[model samples]
Target: MKPLLRLVEEIRHGIPSHYHVDLENRLAIAWGERKRKRFDIKPRSRGENLVATRENRARIIYLQAQDEDCLLFLAFILAYSPRSCVDFKTTEFVEFHDYALDNIQQRASPETEKLLKTMAIRRGFNQNLHYLNYMQTMFPKGIREQEPIGETLVSTAAESVGNEMRIDEIGRDDRGRQIERMYSNGPISQVSMFGELLSNAIQSSHQWRKERGLGESTTNCWTTMIPRDPNEDISITIWLGRRDGHRVNTALMVEPTWSSPSLPMPE
Candidate 1:
């Protein structure tokens, strides 16, 4: 699985990209324009990537995703909004006209349907925390509770010693800190900002770890969260395994970068 931002395009059969703005707006409305803007909800070309390091202009970037990588980002920005707020059925936007139908139909694939259904069944009740707890239970051995390292590590827990275990940590940065506070207080209305990315990162790490023959029946996941620069995007580093102690390297660095000068609307 590619980045959740990228996997989203795999579901887009032939819808024009411009209509995606409607989907982005829907998220802005659901999560509030403030969060939407804070997360940089608007999609941009690969080369169009911008880091707001200036005063009061800071924003978060996921995975340093490039242009070709962002081709599917709109798909996520749209699908996630509905999945987080109302439900998958609400992804359709009549204002976009017939293109909206194409959008909805394209996303009706078995995988997308299954993913959305799982989210509905799993996280529909208590939002992201319920879903997080569900994923934790999937570990071969349950995660062990651990104390936080000051404000840097809001929460840290490691699964039982096994080839298929993960060290989960919630950061203490602005966005992460807020998420921590929300979870400690009560049920949150939406999924954590890093929820989708964390899932993909864990899956990707697991696949790579197994390829290296690190574990007997499963791969290991070493996830650590350290406070990061508020102005910088959150960075996730996946280690091969406890014994390997090496970063899982891939060809993503050399992937071809391409982009359309303009998006052609489908007839």
Candidate 2:
């Protein structure tokens, strides 16, 4: 119950201001702020906006009842909620769940383990096995920014800017806008000419990713040619750091975890 409450609180904090309390609070209240009452509500469209609503109602009922038999049911609901970390819209929800599960498993809670397995079974064959697999990978320790998983090509013109070691301007984007403080690794000129090349490459890569639907310029490793001679192809690496599990969410959206339920299902 405490973990559920914490998860709910996290969703409340992570959502954008527009949907913050307006939509989220309805979930919190409908669940069980007072004595619970059940009623059927009709949907405007093909029930597109209603999955979260139904899940919210169930969460309240379970929370208020504290039914031991329903923990698996509750976990599944909580895991799929748009408010949950799996959705990729709100931040830190997955990490929170991962941390909480680690604590539970560390204490040797078989019931929790059984609950997870049951949820996995339900999700795997009926839905996505990778969902549970990815969730397990995040266990013990969550996705780490220090580790850059994949590299994206920025530009072939690496040597073009390697010599112009503009120390003061390294962190700025192509248009001269300052990069987000967290994403900016201050002037890399002192590191090497390769550093400047990498810095420039990352700027271009961010722009490229933004223009295409490939992914966000949010978190990734940018790689480009670091030439020994003007034509010699060597490479240098520059990592764009992650903020609040941004990379994790992006990864989930990319492959095995990209399992956003179908349009009929609420994202």
Candidate 3:
């Protein structure tokens, strides 16, 4: 199947009757804007080649009608291969869209329906996280976890390991002193257990970073605190890169003030 056709099928399944060729350019524009980047679509001298390429690609568009308001959108799901590009056919495209629509309708409760329009935005974030995870697994060494203060967790962990490897000089430095304290407090020699925990945390953190759009930056930081008490299950905070200062400030400054005071919080 063509990549565009697969995308179309996915979109149809996810979004239903909202697909149209006329809206392809607009959909592409919308995608680029949301990503804050321009898509590289080759310019064609004639419409035939453009249409042919689009048809061969795994893409799906749907015209969503809710009362009077209609929304036309397309989704492209392409997986680049080393040898060649595998595209999705029209049937695959439509099937994917149908799947998407069914998934959406399954969650069409009164409360969820109120947020239905925002589903595409959420889906984009989810897809980004999926891609990030795949990339992390492929290039584990390049995946660095930064602490809140902007130090690499992997480097810190390595230094800690080095210090632990020297058991004779246990209390030589602050790190060694901390290790001594841990050794006295509990079963701290379980290196394998710690490795497993750290590995899981790294994977989870990578997914979190992608979901938050942190990208590949040394300065970005993400933290999550889970209290022992049941009152606070999870608390998350993110610090963006210095280059993203404008975006970070804008997000922080706009959020508290923009929320609807009268709207009930979700359960």
RMSDs, each prediction?
A: 20.9, 19.8, 20.4
Name model 1 segments beyond 4 Å from true: 1-87, 90-150, 163-267
| Candidate 2: worst-modelled 10 consecutive residues by lDDT | 152-161
Write down the lDDT of every candidate, Cα atoms only: 0.30, 0.30, 0.28
Q: Candidate 1 on 1-267: residue-level lDDT in tens?
A: 234424345454433445445533432332221222244666654433332121012111111111112223345454443323222221132222222223332223333323322323332221232223223322222234333333433434334333222324332432443122111111122213335544344444323323233233332233323333465443333322212222222323343344221223322
TM-score of 2: 0.23
Taking all chains together, the TM-score of candidate 1 against the true structure is 0.18
Superposed Cα RMSD, model 2 = 19.8
Candidate 2, number of clashes: 1
Give one digit per residue, the lDDT tens place, for model 3 in 63-116.
111100111122332222211212322233333333332232221223222122
Candidate 2, which segments miss by more than 4 Å at Cα?
1-45, 48-108, 122-129, 138-267
* Per-residue lDDT value at 108 in model 3: 20
Question: How many clashes in candidate 1?
Answer: 1
Candidate 2 residue-wise lDDT, 119-166, digit = tens: 333322211212222222222121111122123212110111222211
